[model samples]
Target: MPSQSKLLSITTWLLGLLTLVAMATQLTIHLRLNFSLVNFFSYFTNLANLLAALVLIATASLRLASRELSPALESARAVSAVNMAVVGIVFSVLLRNVDLGSLQPWVNVLLHYVMPVAVMLEWLLRPPRTRFTARHVGLCLVIPLVYLAYVLVRGAAISWYPYPFLNPAHAGGYGGVALYVAGIALVFWLVACLLLIVPKRRQVRNH
Candidate 1:
């Protein structure tokens, strides 16, 4: 059987590669003369995504340097990737509807959804050193909650939110956005906890 450390290392390295690719792609789009699908998402969502990608990449380094976080800790990190991916998808879709170029629509979906989904699935199948529990769910919520709060405060002053629904000036407004975010957070928490409970053999057998 593969050691947990090895599985984690592989996942971490793959995430690192993807993170680097995303950074490079964004940089290229910014510097190059070519106009592409890079503008499909709001700048805020893209910025958030870039930060999330950085976090995912840094977790790999943390694992390499000190192996301090548990397998569960790594799993918690997976939720961040998922969160950013989903948010990016939502933002990108909004832009697509506004007549952004097709290339950006494709790139947005590919980067924000496809790549993250593939990487997350790889992590899902790896054997857990410990059973999934309530604590695991708690960890999943913490980071996003902090991030959302920061966004809310910033939105209050700047009157800008990543998505229209999140903006206080919109019809549904910040209240509606807050509710939606809370619901998504709850769903994510439950999903993470359920993932922990699923037996490894059953998960792997499906793969």
Candidate 2:
């Protein structure tokens, strides 16, 4: 029988491969539709999934090689897990009913549902040994903030937004967009706090 760590390594590798395949499938669909590669990659869902895939693959590689995992790598995995969770939540709550023309149902499920849940489960099952500080939480927020700014700026220039909620025209102007952004930011912060706090609480209880 495989040891628990070996099983986990296999699982991570499979999940990472699955994510990459889903992404490639989506990219193929987009290409057939003459979609801009830039626009396709710009979606938070795509970016988050990419990050999750990379982290999963890297962690699995390190584990399989019997290498010591770096704290920074573990931190990256935590951040990726948080981002993916938010991606799933925001999509289900805000864009569930939105018509996503040309997006395959299977691809949608993998990106917005399976990957997110799997990433979070992985984090819960194998948490970082290094405790997350408030500094880590703050650092986790940086990527989303930067992504938000990039989306808004790029949207203004090209008039294309990944999600309807972020589009000023669809969101009832910039005010509405601001409200949506603020709400998502709050959600991200709350989730980050919970992820960090829960681990510490668990460690305390175990001691």
Candidate 3:
């Protein structure tokens, strides 16, 4: 019989593989229909999918059981988990009006909703052994900051931002961009705090 950890590992691996396939198929269809690879890759949704899948695969491959992940891996998993949730929330709130007829609707749902929920559930179920400190909050911020810089710089050059709010050409302009960044940064921090709380709560329960 498979151990509980082994079962957990297998479950994550299957979910990750499912997410990757759905994402890949959707992206392939999107590229074929739109013929704009650059535009496709620029979306934060795609990046989130990629990040979640990679993190899940890494966890499964390492056979990470319990809440005992190394600090670095724990941080990575936390960031990735939050990124997935952000993708779903942002899509529903900000991008729901955007038509997604090019890709299968089910795949779209999987990428935006199912996978994000799955990642979050995984995070909650497998709280890390190492509780993140306030300082690691800054480290968690780095990935999103880098993502924002990439979008802004690329959009500046090509006049094509992945999201309307992030585009200077849109109504918000630089101010809008700043506002979006600030809002997202706040969200990121809140999510990080939630992630941190899990481990600390578990520690408390143990004592």
Candidate 4:
């Protein structure tokens, strides 16, 4: 039988490759349908998916390069894993109306759902050795906060927001946008805390 770490490495590497392929394929078709590169990258979903895929690739590469994992790499994995979790939850719970008309059904599923689930599962099942604290959890919000600021400012200026909830023209105005942002922020923090609680997996077979 393959060792647990070996199996996880392989699975994660495969996930990373598949996610990139799916995103690329979808983006190709999407761009052909009057979507500009700037507009495409502006979406939080694409950003989150890109982050997840890149981090997964990094994790896989680190494993390949050496058996011993560095703290930096592990921390990066943690952040990316949490980011993807947020992606899946936010898409399903909040951004249900953002149609992916150009995306094939399977690719859509992979980008929005399966990839996020896979990242979380990989973290839970084969967590790297690192103990995260409340500080780390607090820091986890940094990137998302920056993203929120960017989107809101850009949206306000150009009258274009990626999702309906964040769009001032459609998201019920400033106050409504605040409510949605606050709610999503709360959910993101809570989910980050949950992901940080990686139980010690003692055996591969049992898992």
Candidate 5:
């Protein structure tokens, strides 16, 4: 039987490759329809999946090379895990019934469902080696807050928002969008807390 490290490396490689394929396929479909590349990449789902794929691939490569992941990379893994969790939850709850006009079915499943679940499971099964702190949780929120700002600013400029919930027009105006943003931020915080707490509990049980 392969050791735990070997198994983890293989799993990460497979998942990372799968994520890349899904994102690539989606990108092709988007370009074929003449969609803005900027808008396509701006979706939190795409960005989170991209980050998750990179972190997974990088972690696998370092492990295979017998090199330890840097603390920064490990923290990235933690943040990516939290991001993917929120992606899954938000999509299922808010966007599952919404028409994503150009998105292919298989790609949708991979990005909105499979990759998110896989990334979270990977984190749960193989939690970060570095201990997490309040600072780490804060780090988890940084990209999300940045993404929120970018979406609002860009949406204001182009009159387009990736998710309807983020669109003032669709959401009944900026106030409604604010409500959605506040709710999503709360979700991010809760998921980040859970991710941090779970690993500590696991370590305690093992000890």
Candidate 6:
């Protein structure tokens, strides 16, 4: 039974990897093309899909019930699921409608702030406590940084970017783009910290 559970966990990670890859690839292509296509199903909307796939994969991984499972793995998986779901749904709505100016500002609120907030709340309340450690945290940071760097270099080589925020010309400049990217990185870091720290408090309080 334990072996079977491990298999399931591995499968979940692999699925997440695939989803992240696909979304990242699509983001690269779309940015390179400079939003050339306006259709909902085209490259512009693929980010949401990638996010959805990631959310599903994370969900699967977090649901694993085994004594051998690590607390860190479970927490990471749970947080990733919530973040991805919020991102996916927002992107999906944005893709379906290009005329953001016409809609009420509150609509934007629903897509951007509300969804993420709800997801974050869910994550905070149900924080995981399993096989997590400092090493796992480092691995998490490294993987995303490596991917971001690789994608940026790849985009530069082809005179394309993977997202609007990555496009220096469209935004304030490369500096502006860099700043935005930094902000995103900070947010990711915060999420990681929250996931890592909160569980300890809960455990102690319960004890």
lDDT of each: 0.58, 0.91, 0.82, 0.81, 0.90, 0.52
Please say which candidate is ahead in TM-score: 1 or 3: 3
Residue 181, candidate 5: C-alpha displacement in angstroms: 0.3
**Model 1 TM:** 0.61
State which candidate has the highest TM-score. Answer: 2
lDDT of 2 by residue, 1-207 (tens): 249989989998998998899899989999998999999989999999999999999999988888877989988987998899899999999999999898889989989999999999888887777788999899789999999999999999999999999999999999999999999999889889888776787788789
lDDT of 6 by residue, 1-207 (tens): 466656655655565565556444544665566654432132222433344345545555555643343554464555454344435443554333544432235434543444455445545655666645676556446544664576567667776764555667766887887786686566556556556676778888889
Instruction: State the lDDT of candidate 4 residue by residue for 80-131, as single tens digits.
Output: 8888888888889876566766768888789888998998888887676776
**Model 2 CA deviation exceeding 4 Å by range:** none
lDDT tens digits, residues 1-207, model 1? 246866676666676566557656765765575543333233444554555566556655666576565664566555554455455455555444543332355456646665556445545654444454576667667766776677678678767555555666763866788776776577656655655565445656667
Each candidate's TM vs. the true structure? 0.61, 0.95, 0.88, 0.89, 0.94, 0.52
Error of 3 at 191 (Å): 1.1
Residues 39-78, candidate 5: write the lDDT tens digits: 8999999999999999999988888888888989989988
* Model 6 error, position 97 (Å): 9.5
* Global fold similarity of model 3 (TM-score): 0.88
Kindly provide the TM-score of model 5 when superposed on the true structure, using C-alpha atoms: 0.94
Q: Tell me the spans in candidate 4 whose CA falls farther than 4 Å from its real position.
A: 199-207
- Report how far residue 27 has shifted in candidate 4, in Å: 1.9
Count backbone overlaps in model 6: 6
- Model 6 earns a TM-score of 0.52
Tens-digit per-residue lDDT, 19-88, candidate 3: 8898778778877776688777777888888888888988887765444456778788888887887887
Which of the two, 2 or 4, has more TM-score?
A: 2
- Residue 132's lDDT within candidate 1 is 47
Clashing pairs in 6: 70-130, 70-131, 71-130, 71-131, 72-131, 72-132
Which candidate would rank higher by lDDT, 3 or 5? 5
Q: Model 6: which ten-residue window has the lowest total lDDT?
A: 38-47
